[model samples]
Target chain A: MSKQTVFLVGATGETGESILRALLDDGSFEVTCFIRTASAHKPSVQRLKDKGLKVVFGELSDSTENLANLLVGIDTVILSIFAFDVGVEASLIQAASMARVKRFVPCGFGTPCPRGGVMALRDLKEVVHDQIFTLHLGYTIIDVGYWYEISSPRVPSGKFDYAIMVPRNKVIEGGTAPNMLIAKKDVGAITARIIKDDRTLNKRVYVCGDILTQNEINSIVEEKTGEKLELTNETTADVRKDLDQMNRAVQDDPSNLAHKYRLSNAQYNLSKYVRIDNTPEIAEYLGYIDGRKLFPDYVFQKFSDFVNDLAAGRVQRPYPHVSL
Target chain B: MSKQTVFLVGATGETGESILRALLDDGSFEVTCFIRTASAHKPSVQRLKDKGLKVVFGELSDSTENLANLLVGIDTVILSIFAFDVGVEASLIQAASMARVKRFVPCGFGTPCPRGGVMALRDLKEVVHDQIFTLHLGYTIIDVGYWYEISSPRVPSGKFDYAIMVPRNKVIEGGTAPNMLIAKKDVGAITARIIKDDRTLNKRVYVCGDILTQNEINSIVEEKTGEKLELTNETTADVRKDLDQMNRAVQDDPSNLAHKYRLSNAQYNLSKYVRIDNTPEIAEYLGYIDGRKLFPDYVFQKFSDFVNDLAAGRVQRPYPHVSL
Candidate 1:
């Protein structure tokens, strides 16, 4: 009957920040953010501390002993950190298990990685998931296929400074894959609810604000903004081919840090948008059924709702650059 | 055209060693084995060197500049290393590009890693594939689904130290998924041919010795060996559930080296046998069609031929523990 003490990693990013706000607003759980000590001086961290959020200093890549110390007395650990080493999440999971955290949620706020597909980001998720599963820890995985902000100018990851799949003037050719896009705020709210709801324990939980196709999204943008953005007719195959070429280029010149960054961005984008064939079956496969059927009591915010919110300026601009 | 030069990585491995023998026997291409400097003292490396095979000492994880130096004047680079760091192959790829190696063959002699699947081995393959593609390097991906040695007592990879799927007396219950398996010798022969044939450039070259379901494979063992192994009635679902649990255990204690090894073996076995549903379409998808029909010129060693060879003591008993 006691309030759960929450330890949150990746508290500075958009999703992490949103989740933090939701956890604080819930007023039932005690929230603590585990951030890198070096980045603790950032304004965002300062603001969170000012809001009475407990901020712990630690790096995910740190030794398990140190991470365990950080997770002590924390009932739940929610990770929203970006991918670093493949072992980072595994290390955190080890620490949480040592500390005996009641529930652990590793960052999965995307599509369910295909069972045997290769995609570094998705594979990293798999590695972490394998470690979590092997450890017999109580866990929850959130699968939000894509973010609407991918189509917005202000990027959350900040690696890709512009829109990827659905930029202002360009839509991928045959952009009809049913995109299960979720808002950062919705992700936060839903995650907070799931944390409170014990039913989601040790299971893969699905969260999506709306399921919209690229063509449908393009049309919605036109309606909302009163302009037709350039809809480029490049296919998913083209993106994959180009990704392959660019990656080779990176290999050719390991000194090209810019190309490596570009490769990373492309890899992330391809995993998010191009890898999975866009189909209703895929949407249904990626927890659309579970998201709707399991959480019958909760109403999800729709893509239209998000667009309407954006059009009415009821919400802040879609993508806000979050400082480190 | 001048005789092509091949810089082969992992020449001491089971498949790598076989490929090396075939390439040497061909006498058309100039074959150079790029091995780790640390492994230069291994008997296998010494034997290859004794055979007048060019054994170049350079680790795949070496710097691009150094690897480039090792790959200088190499016409093609073929990687046959086991799953290791994602960057190792990428580093070699960078070197190959720098050295202007005309063709690069990555290690993908297994089930196709689904585009966004979480399977770690497949994901590693994906990572290597991405680097190859992004670099705009020439590539020939050989997807040989599974190896027949999984049922053989003589395992190639000494780490597992035992037959994984086909234990002496057990069979997965309802094991009906058709496994597309190939012989290491066939793989060697076909690869050598592919290297000589310019038609296979930049294409996904499929190769299969045989495709058989677990039930069929079990029956074959019974017929060939005149012994009925205990047919354990475990389902794919069971394997997956157990994998999930075992993975959780690994997460709980990341330092448990045995657990990590078991987890890796479990992952590789699951990807090879359990993950994909045994549908005819999937069989076609994993290169069965192209392997069986596309290359009429190449005759693959059949499963029957392999069993007969084993019966006659023509093929060396599998799972030979080669000293490093």
Candidate 2:
């Protein structure tokens, strides 16, 4: 049988790198990475090229006709672009439709956000989802809760930085609610399996490595590292106050780039700590198939294991800086 | 004070004509109508031009740069385009933002649809609304209820056609749900007042000329026209059946244009007769300000008055055919 050809965008980012790695390691499908001309000469992109991964140079701002020509004969297209670049997805999706791609996997690798939520980011994501559905394009939407790398306690070593992660010793609102978390590598492996399986076509696939609250996560880090970190409880009211201030700032100056970024940061934190709508039950209610149920034999890396890796300095920093 | 400069799209459309007439009659704004090259020479377009309305030849498919150039010096931009043309609104909106227009009124001149309804058309409209809000542009969203011209009993003289309206002498469900109704002229006048009021800035304005059930409307028409039209009840189950069949056709052949149009028509019917989300109470809960409350002194044309007009042959068919 001929190998399936996959086209990937945003291949230099952390999640995109993991996906590219897994697809390459699977060795069953041909993989192509779409990179911006500015990033075409990076060492990481050069490494992928050396590994026999085909690279295409182009920008998302390119015309739909041009992008469609680049997507000819591609079986599936995976998007792992940044959230801020979401507005451009319309033209890309239209290009995919014009190219007659078999399936589309959009960049929705986050919590299960119901429509009409407080997060404008999720609303923007929903627009992309709706557009694909309206066009009758075959799609598999994957949302893998929060990343353990971001939710875990920050390593004290100066080698790694946590720009947007929660503070080191803060527990948000008793932190008893069970939140989903996954390793980035698992997201890649699951995505690889999902794309190869016909059962996941035109469905939402929810992936989770472990379900742990903020307090439980902290407990694992403390037990694994023996650091005796002191924790403080931050009330939901405080979070609401901060979010309100950020919202007002954006409202007062909608065109201010800095204020918009700060507002998005506040909204991200709210989705992680204050919103309880991302639970497994809610996901099921929203018609998502559990990834664990789909691939029961595959073992998942636990949060405790990640904590041990951080304590032993065995975990490499994925990126220099993470934006919310 | 100087008159506000307005740029209008869909000027030849029925709703757009009313809005244009209202704005021109108010004498408070200078209006420019954007027309496609094909429509530029039409008699309707000629009439608008004869009335001293500035006419610009352009298409929605125009590039954002080109559209922005046409919008230069315009204070507010109003869209009254058809639902199928919604995908083109993004570029036009981006152009408006680039031109730094003070206010934008999107093409939402229909029922007050809440987010995440059964209607795909409404979902598309919500995407436009979200885009405007995300851009932080000055805007007001307007949703009038069902149009009296479309929902009223058909005139018997064969002067008008009801291709997409409810079948003659038929009542949907119990026909007791108080649906909002407005004349096209009222939509125009209310929109004119809304665009001029600072209190409606960055808000949703719900407009209604009257609120009546299908049964009440039938009785009024029968008494006024004295044409004993027998009414048959169409159950909600039958409507759901039709909608489900249309949905399956679209799903089976998403690329079929005919199937898509049929599905849209079924969805429009379902939204009008099956959904209860367009009520004034629901709109209020969704944070919409009532237009009647905003302008209590302006007498609106009631449904009864519209029935009398139909009986007297004083009403004109706004368009040859209304597409769902």
Candidate 3:
């Protein structure tokens, strides 16, 4: 069979880069990535181009006709842009549909943001999902929950700037609420495998590395670090109170970036992270018998491996993407 | 006491125009309506300006700094813009907050759109609500359900061009499911009264004329028009089936506007119109004991009155705003 042509937007971003690398390594599809010319000088863009991947330069808000022209003959269009660029992402969806792309994957690689909570990004993601549904594009939404790199305090990636689940010396909200977290590279591999899979078409797929509580994560961190670190337990109510204060701070100084950061972190703690007891229940909610059971052929990386990678200095400590 | 300086956005649109008229007639608030200069030559703008109404020309995406400067003395900001202008609305919310406006009333004049449900506009409204909540802006969300002028079949307002409730000879879906319908004028009057009322601050309010089924609306139309219209009953399941077909049609030919119209109408039938037995339950949802019991002093125009007004050529059947 002839190889399918895939167009990926935001290929320089963390999620985009991971997915792009995974797809390229698979060598089954002809991969093309759209990058902003403004960031063409970046080393990441040069690295991707050097890896024998096709690269195109354009703004996210490129005219629909122009975007459609670029998407010509592409079988799938995967948008992995920042959630805040919802308008741009919407335009891309329209353009992809206009170009008659058979499949479209939006940047929904987290919890299902069904409603707007304190996080504007989550709300915007919800809006994007709505737009995709209304446009009736042949789409697949991947809700992979949180990533381990940011949540694991041992690594303390720049992306985890919000002290959500710091390895030590942090208060974990709802410490015992079993939550799902996947390694970022694993997300890339899973997405690459599913892009052309018919089962994923017009559906939402939930994937994860491990399902464990914050306290469990803390235990894992201690085992890897070989040192005891301070850990505090905070109730959900305490987190909400902080969110309320952050909300006020945002209102008082709308331009303050720190207040926005605090508000974002507070919201993620209060709503965005999903807590599922077991794989079966989560799989049921995701419209499957069990995600792991369904994908028996694929093996996800373990949290211990992620911890070892952090200790060995193999994991990227400073995330290149903008903080959420 | 000096009148509150109210900055009104989209004051020339259907709901906005109605609210503007109500506020002007009351002569309580010093009303200022923001209008895009591209539409400055429109007769609506001229008419408002002719009536000594303060008209400011600017884009919705005018930098927040510029918008804040314009809103320096405004006590409240009321946004009744088209639902499709969500990006613009977000900018307005930020601008309003930056301006330190005391209260904000977003374009939540219809049903409450809590999440994305096959409707992009509803999802956008949800995002706007989230933005308002996150910003900690003092706000009032008015869920007035459906407007009688548009939803009533005998009067086919241009705004209801999507064939939701048509002028006779149409199958009404879920005819027995009760819904709250209010006159557009009443929405304006009620909103005008509540803009400055402390009771409405930071809360959602549901106001309605009558809670009745589509069959009842058809009966009222027949009673007023003195003509027995050909009406047929259809189930919500039938509507969902049509929506599914529309969804497929849109996927097949994404640019087909007709498919979009069909999908929009089907979604409206399935979700937009409220289904309730009585006012008290709806009141509970809107956080009130009972809307009627709470607002005993305000008299909402009856469905019979609406029908008579339509038959007597008092109701403006050709809506000035674009169709949803």
Candidate 4:
């Protein structure tokens, strides 16, 4: 059988890199990375090129026609860019539609929250989803909840050095609500499987390695590292208060970088920890196919295993820390 | 004060014509109509041009940069196009943002409905709304419920000629819930007032001439015409069943024109008659300023007056009949 041809954007980003590596390792798909011309000289991009991956340099600001021309002959187009780049993603979706690509995997790799919430980013992502759905594009929307790489507290092992991942070891309301977590690498593997599976076409797929509350995750880490981590508890009301303040600040001065950053952080915390709508049951209610159920035999790395890796210094933080 | 330079799309459309007439009649704003080159030779475009209206020929499919160039020097951009032209509207919004237009009025001149409903068109409009808000473009979303021109029952008068306006004299579910209604001409006049008023900036404005149930409207029409029009009542459940069937048909064949038309008709019925979420209280709850409250002294044409005009063969249907 002929190999499936894939075109990917944001391949240099953390999630995109994981998907790229997984697709490459599978050796069953012809992968092409669509990197920005500005990022063409990046070592990460160059490394992908050296690995025999096809590279296409273009700008997201390019005309839809131009983007469509570039997407010609591609069977599937996968977007993994930042959620804020809605306009870019919109243009890409239009371009993919024009190119008559068979399938489109949009950038929605996160928790499943209801629309019209305090999270402005989710609203933006909803716009992209509506565009793809309304255009009747063959698409697969994958939400892998929170990434396991960023779900852990800062340990004494020093391997996971991102302080912003869990600020001050503060967990929300004891984190009693079950939250879905997936390793970043597993997201790529699951995405690869999802795009190729006919059942996932035009549907939302929920991929998760484990479903554990923040307290459960912390307990697992403590057992693995043999050290108790001091934790601070914050209520959802507190998060809501912070979110309201941030919303007002952003509304007052939308162009202020500091205000925008603070608003995004509050929104992220609210979505990841404060909200209790990230469980498998919520995913089912939202009409998401269970990835674990779909691939029952495929073993997924648990939170404990990730904690072991962090304590053993075998894994490192995937993204840099941006101090709030 | 200098006249606000206004750029308008869909000037030849029913709602656009109303807005264009209102803006021109107000004599307080300088209006320029952006029309498609393909429609340049139409009588509507020529008639506008003859009235000393500035007409710019361009297509919505034009590049964002090209559209932005045309929007230069315009203080406000008004979109009165069809709701289905969401992609076109998004590009125009981008261009408006790029051109630094002070305010944008999106194409949402209809009953106020919540997002993510069975009405796909509402979802499409939401996308445009999100884009304008996310881009930090100053925007005013105006929703003027059902148009009075089509809201009335068909009388013996030959002036009101559209049969599709209220097909078979069918009304939904006893119609006890108050539904907002506004004259098409009033929509344009209200929109003109809304754009000029500083209060409506970055807000949603709900314009209504009357809030009456279907039975109330029918009684008003019966009194005006001195003739009882035969009416058939349909329940909300019946409309929902039709909507579901149409939805399935559209899902099976998205490109089928018949299925699309049926789906849209069912959705329109559901939003207009079946749904009770279009009242002033609902609008206020949804953060919309009441247009009637904003301009208390302004005389609005009530349903009784509209019925009288229809009986006297004064007002004509703005839109043509599309057999469904």
Candidate 5:
């Protein structure tokens, strides 16, 4: 385990810096950064170098021999790179198996999926995820679901504002009160802790950075920014229509869908991860505290901060869902 | 042209071998083989080394760096490697563009496609093919219909025992030919010609090794071998039935249709490549005199030859397509 080396792709991206800092801050693991050039040296790589981690640069078109020099001693890999197709994950996994790399942590940092949730997908990530069953390497997808860092600002988001794509008008059959939200820095902290802990090895670690319900966030935003973030809580049919509308938007713009894995999920299961009671292993992970209990008031604080930002027009507006 | 170096993946695979021989035989092109070995000796590598082709091995899991080294001093690239995932082909093409490789030829060495043929597939290969539009590199996919290779006498094929998987009786709807067959040697020849020909530089060059029909092959086997061969035609419905039944059989069996890609293609349209008329490019390349004009006596001769082999037990009998 001490000999395991982690190769990081797209280390300069948004989420990469957190993982890089986490991995580098801990001295137990060795890390390698696969960069293309020193011409546009990323501060992260320099930081990793400054902190005594190895950095390598190479082309993806070159032969295996040419790149062999870089992967010589690597064991684990953390990939966050985004391309036109996330299906490249499978190829990378295949290559990793060929190279005899041991463990892999894919960029599945989504909500900790229910077992069935992962199986229902036929998307590129799902296809690649399925291949893991046939390969010899061990993989643990750290589903730090919908990081607080990346979610839409809920503060100033009110009646005039949309309900974060989920419906606000009708009563959700189950209602959306269970999920716990987490800050991105907390996600980074959890990631560092999980990897550093031998107990979590080969286990699906559900790290809800801060646990707060969508309802709580909404209420919090209404309180903080006084904006009514009206979710279209219509009939089931209407909810489905809205979900379809969102999905259609993503599909319409392939470049956008490609970037985010064509999200706009059809399930309308956005708040599904609100509760960590979903996983028995998760219950066991922290002695059954479940994520929400850990951060009881996460949404109100996060949403308030988000509303402050929205008031300043700090974040980009919702992209129009046009057909591709 | 003299300074143009070409990179070839799958250099030792069946199609790669042909492309390699074609590029090397041209004498005007420089060639490099990207292999999987890291300073390890492989039979294919030795052959290429003997022919003065540089060999570079790059892991698919690592960064694109290995490919970049070969990209330098290279102006054109013939990517015969089949990276069947979504972004891999695009990424490599993007790398080629980055490397400034002017001309790129993808491994599109199969029959010309209609709207729904392989061109419409969402698989990794199609994903890579789609990248052609996004990437600035000049690219062409040479579509060679099925190749018919003559087996050595020592390992000669017995009887007219060739198995072509088609979607039920609708095989003709898809690009795959139910009747037409191409010789393997001709496949090599045609692709070699396509690579060397300036006329097909940007277009799909199609070629058929021979214009023989499926029924003719079966009939010829009876005539040639002086034996009766049992033919089993599995319709798409029958295949689906079997596949559904053998869903459990695929767990341990390799030949089960339950898990085979062939079963999944039962709904595919296969008639396009079956008809020689659909492929004017290949028909032109072979100088077709038309099957109707030359087949009366020739069919009898070929059928008899195939039949004699079957009678002699030279050809292996096919398994019945019953669900396991």
Candidate 6:
């Protein structure tokens, strides 16, 4: 069989690189990555170039014509890029469908939305996912919940106090959500395995770490480092109420447009996925990850794109940049 | 009070021109007519130019940077351009608000979609209008119900052979639902009048034509013509059901996206303000155009734009472009 060209968007991010690495190991595929920003001085991007992967840099809102060129012969695509909760996903997916790309892997590193309370992920998702299904594109979503990488950045020990930003304030305090800390490599392996597995077609699956509930995950932190991790549960609901209030306030103050947009996006992304209790699912994926030998890509392209967006200044104030 | 410099979009369309003429007569506004298709033909644009109006040509797409110049020193704007249900209206309104234009008028030239049960129109009203209000743009809607010029273009001739298109395809040979007919000129007048009237701010007002109940319209036709005017009243229910069915069919057919857009638009325009069993509000604005007056400069501006659009092929099959 001829080798397939799999276009991976957002290949320059820390997590996206892992996914790209796994896709590269597949003998039957050649991978191309789309990035919107590239700094030659940046170590990660230059390293990616050294690996000999094709990288095309362009904005996320690139029109249909530009997309048609990138999609011309690609057999499969893994979308890991997103905007700040706008109609970008649906628009990009529609463009890809028009370009006749064979299969699409949407940025679904969370529980499936339908399995949740039919709550909208973002306003765009309400409009977009419907557009995706209605457009009749063959799609598979990588349901690898939240990434530890984004939330758990390393800082000098005791130099900085621990503070975690939750979607809003949660029910149970201190990390009640299950977080099976699957090594990045394990996440990578699962992604690569799915591309080769026909059974995963048109499906949404979980990829996680250890079988750990929110409490267990916190315990694991204690056990590993012997330093108690400060815990916080931020319920998405409280955040939404705050955002709704902010939106009302914004109507009276045009100056608050950006802030309202940010809050709304936060609420949308946090609530978009299936409301998995996560303890069982995280354990299940953690077991699966432990059983695997080689690392698989965790489909971190979207996160990677998020990084490029920050580096290029398309988006001001990253989550890390925001104090509150 | 200083006169406001108003920029009018789609000033050449039926209602748009009316709005322009009304504003022109009020003597409190300086109008800049936005001409989309007259880029190369300055003399063609000169029809408005001769009347001492400024004209600028460009596509009305959301990202048209040229609009920045038009927005400069522009105190108010009237957007009348329509695309086959695209996402540009709110984006443009936001742009206007950002430019600090004091007042904006939306192209709400139909039975207020709220009263009308057309889904596409309803969707447009929700998404577009909500976006406008969010932008904090002071706006008004000229809620004209139906165009007399667009329907039954030639009045009942002596023979009364002219055909009328109704939502009901299977009505009894002679049933009558109310037919509210406003000439294109009246639509323009209502649009023009809305922007100038302080009472119109933050409000939507209905513009109706000579309101004759279905039987009255047919009888009037019979009175004017030597032969009996055929009377057909498709019950509002049957017409709505048919329109809903057509809307679903059009939405499903991707290849016919543009055509479906037009059909749904027509269905929306025709279904509303049929005086289902009550008062037709045409009486409110009937006095606005008591006589066929001179070639109002604004009306001429519209005619000129239509000629330009026709010549430039911009008038390609309009949505619901009736074959009649």
RMSD of 3: 15.6
A184-288: candidate 4 lDDT, tens digit per residue? 888888888888888777677898999998889888877777877878888989998988998998899987766877887688777667656677765654456
A57-163: candidate 6 lDDT, tens digit per residue: 66657777777777888878786554333356555676678888777776655432332122334234435544554445666556554554333322224322233
C-alpha TM-score for every candidate: 0.50, 0.53, 0.52, 0.54, 0.40, 0.42
Ranking by TM-score: 4, 2, 3, 1, 6, 5
lDDT of 3 at A137: 66
Query: In model 5, what lDDT does residue B34 have?
Result: 78
lDDT (tens digit, per residue) of candidate 2 on B5-88: 999998889799899989989999999999999887789999987888799998888899999999999999999987667757
* Model 5 vs. true fold: TM: 0.40
The per-residue C-alpha lDDT of model 1 at residue B209 equals 75
**RMSD to native, candidate 2:** 17.2
**Chain B superposition TM-score per model:** 0.86, 0.91, 0.87, 0.93, 0.65, 0.69
Better of 4 and 5 by DockQ: 4
The recovered share of true contacts, given per candidate in order, is 0.00, 0.00, 0.21, 0.00, 0.00, 0.00
Best by DockQ: 3
TM-score winner between candidates 1 and 6? 1
* Reference-based lDDT, each prediction: 0.68, 0.79, 0.71, 0.79, 0.50, 0.52
Report, to 2 decimal places, the DockQ of model 5: 0.01
The alpha-carbon deviation from the true structure for residue A187 of candidate 4, after best TM-score superposition, in angstroms, is 33
Tens digits of lDDT, candidate 3, A115-143: 44445776676567666655556777777
By lDDT, highest first, what's the ranking?
4, 2, 3, 1, 6, 5
lDDT of 5 by residue, B1-324 (tens): 354577777777666776777666666667777776663486657887787778877754445565565578776677655423224454567678777776677765554433222222324444454455334346555555443322111112332334322212222222134433454334444544455545444343454434454455544544554555444454445545644544444456756543544333322223232223235433333222232232222221132344354345554322234231
Report the error of model 3 at residue B134, Å.
16
Candidate 6's displacement at residue A84, Å, is 22
TM-score of decoy 3: 0.52
